[model samples]
Target: MSHVTPALYATLAEIVPELHVHCVEPWCVIGSAAALLAGADVSVADVDLLVSRADADTLMTLWAERRESVYEPAGAERFRSHFARFRFPGLPVEVMGGLELDQGDGWKPVKARRLTLAGLNGLAVPVPSLDDQIRILESFGREKDVQRAKALRALASSPLRGED
Candidate 1:
């Protein structure tokens, strides 16, 4: 699945009452899918979610219905939903709920956040902080991936373009 629907958003909201999760790469680029469709070769594989660790179980339950048989590359337990859509190539949107890809430190959301993307039907979601993303990506040097992480860093630094 590539694009997450309102139902999925509602389901996700059921889990994380306070959805302060930030939208990161792949997904961040979703608003710009038209650019890719217009001759840009970008990979829209998965949604790198950074949600509160506390809501992990809640989210798991919502997506449990479509759970597919897939293993995590890091050897952690993997969960999947067959219904999510993919607006990009090869990458089916994924939920990066916690820090350790599934078994690490995930933040406890302080508040609920309304999703800004269109078609979400005004639902809230969860995710992690920008600094964490930079730290994790910076630890190892995967040039391309790290570069992508930089975008998160930028967004974090400037919460609102007009605010600064």
Candidate 2:
């Protein structure tokens, strides 16, 4: 399992201090990051934040000025709802709201209420619970996600060591 580097946690604490942040990607909380943080081996990449429409708008406005580049507009015609991808201080940041996930047969919208505050190095960042993560991962049903869900399930069954 790959652990979230102290540097990365520090960077997250600095930039997304108040926004509701969640690790929707496998890189941070599904492999090493999850194992390190939750006693499960999981892989994590960049940070994926599930923000409210208001918070997303606030981040869009803030990032638009500070971002190195705008990878996607907030309301691109290609997507069914609002989403934005950008680089903030060299970190890959993805802010999504009202976006739907491909559920094989159809699409399901991601809800913001699923996120709850979890402490990482004493900084409060929002993330889904283990059950929610597993459910979301299962809904995606990709090979990697299935593997991630398996790992997370094992971790969830065990007692957590301590907060990250």
Please name the candidate that would achieve the greatest lDDT relative to the true structure.
Answer: 2
Q: Compared with the true structure, what per-residue lDDT tens digits does model 1 show for residues 56-157?
A: 444455555644446343323422221222222323334444333222344222221222332233442322233433454454344654664665556555
* Candidate-wise lDDT, in order: 0.36, 0.55
lDDT of 2 by residue, 4-115 (tens): 6654575566665545343223212222233234434655555565555666677778678655463654324223445576654434566665556654556667553354
Clashes of each: 18, 13
For model 1, the run of ten residues with the poorest summed lDDT: 29-38
